[model samples]
Target: MLYFLKHKLVLLATPKTGSTALEQALAPLADMVLQGDPRIKHCTFQRYKWRMEKFIQIFEDEPPQTAALIRHPEDWLGSWFRFRHGSWLNGTTRSTRGLSFDQFVDGYLAEPQPAFAAVGQQARFLTHPKTGETVTHLYRYDAMSEFVAFLGQRLATTITLGRLNVSPEKELRLDPALRSRLEQRYAEDYALYDMALDKHPG
Candidate 1:
């Protein structure tokens, strides 16, 4: 995530949403750049605001306007599966080498998910911890050009993002029943994605 002091904007790093690539392009220009641990780098908008309270009170005088990117629910989960299945995780519990896309979705919907499918929910990640609110601005992962354009206008600078940390190519053909279960279980994710779409309807 990056904070632009001059613009009072906070760019949240939503996992599997090209955040690392944008970070590379924008970090040098940010007032504060949060990196390292995934938890910190992908900090929720609410937590970021709370964490920066003292800084805002002392310097900026108010919390920054926050924004985040989100992918389709199925696509996000598929990315997690493919990423774990990559050769880099060869012998780890996080590897999905022997699992099918259907099995991965089952594990994701399991009461106690296996490490390979235990990635956190996108909706929960974007929600405010206390107020149950969400980000001030939301962008679709598939509509990156729109997102970059919005950011360019807001920050008054061109943003040139590049591919980074891409998951390996994998065919995600989920079983009909299992896909239904996933959609039902994670309905909130789709709901939020739809909400974002409404914001920038084409």
Candidate 2:
């Protein structure tokens, strides 16, 4: 995550939503950058709320406005499948080496997900567990231009992003039944994405 104290902006890093690229571009301008542990690096809004409360106590200032990205649920899962299919994760429980995209989704939909398909939910990451509210600002992963323009206007800097943490190319076709199931299960994420697209149609 990147925190710009002067701008009172906290850009939450939503995994597989081009966060690495944004971090590379904006880290130089951020007052604070956290990327050491995957846990802290991908810290969700619910978790960050407590951290920010303590952080702002020193300054006696309100917490910064927050933002994050949400990708199409199926595409997000596809990225995870391809990412874990890499040789780097071979032989590990997290590896998706032998699994097809459909199998990965099946595992994900299971009550107890297999390690490879155990990626956390985008809706949950952006949501406040108690309040069921999301971030102040949200952008779609496929809509990078809108997100970049917002950053430029908010931060008053021309931001340029480079692709990072890109997964290998693969044909990830989900079964019709599985696709429907994904949309049904992740309806909140789909709604949030639609809201973002409507709010920032540019």
Candidate 3:
């Protein structure tokens, strides 16, 4: 939302891909920052469908440059899970009642719900929403250093990389079985990430 409001760049803030870092870097440059709910990654189609006309009207009044970041599906999910549940450094708590990685994968595969699926989907939509116009830039999280440089050039300001928002030492303790299951669950996301990597080739 900072992208759209300030640089006129609509950034599709993908989850667990160093989005918080990007937001911080851009904070000084932004005209306004609109944060999404911590629970929901982005404004979903279903949620906005009811007010689509009004949303478009609001956009019509805004400037146009937009950008976003995306990451490999498995990596993104791993980071998300770790940040939300496994991060001992940040005092995060593992949920005792939530579905296991395998179960979550099953649900994700059965239904690609935006809220439940990977964050890359949000990045894709930001770049190419159902409304049709492509975003000005679509950045890959793996190439964040370069992307940051690009932003510096565009915004004409220097940016410094900071520590990740949620760093969990406990992530090291995650079972290999669970890790593999999560990776397998986000196989499609891996493919998409590969495609993005290929396109950028940094």
TM-score of each: 0.94, 0.94, 0.61
Q: Can you write out model 3's per-residue Cα lDDT over 13-79, one digit (the tens) per residue?
A: 5666676777776766775555657534354333333343245447567445555566766556556
Candidate 1 local lDDT, 79-154, one digit each (tens): 9999999899999999999999998899999989988889999988888767878888898898888888888888
Query: Which predicted model would earn the best TM-score?
Result: 2
TM-score of 3: 0.61
Model 1 lDDT on a 0 to 1 scale: 0.86
What C-alpha lDDT values do all the predictions have? 0.86, 0.86, 0.53
Ranking of all candidate structures by their TM-score, best first: 2, 1, 3
Q: After superposition, how far is residue 64 of candidate 2 from its true place, in Å?
A: 1.2
lDDT score for candidate 3 against the true structure:
0.53
Residue-pair clashes per candidate = 0, 0, 6
Query: Candidate 2: misplaced stretches above 4 Å?
Result: 198-202
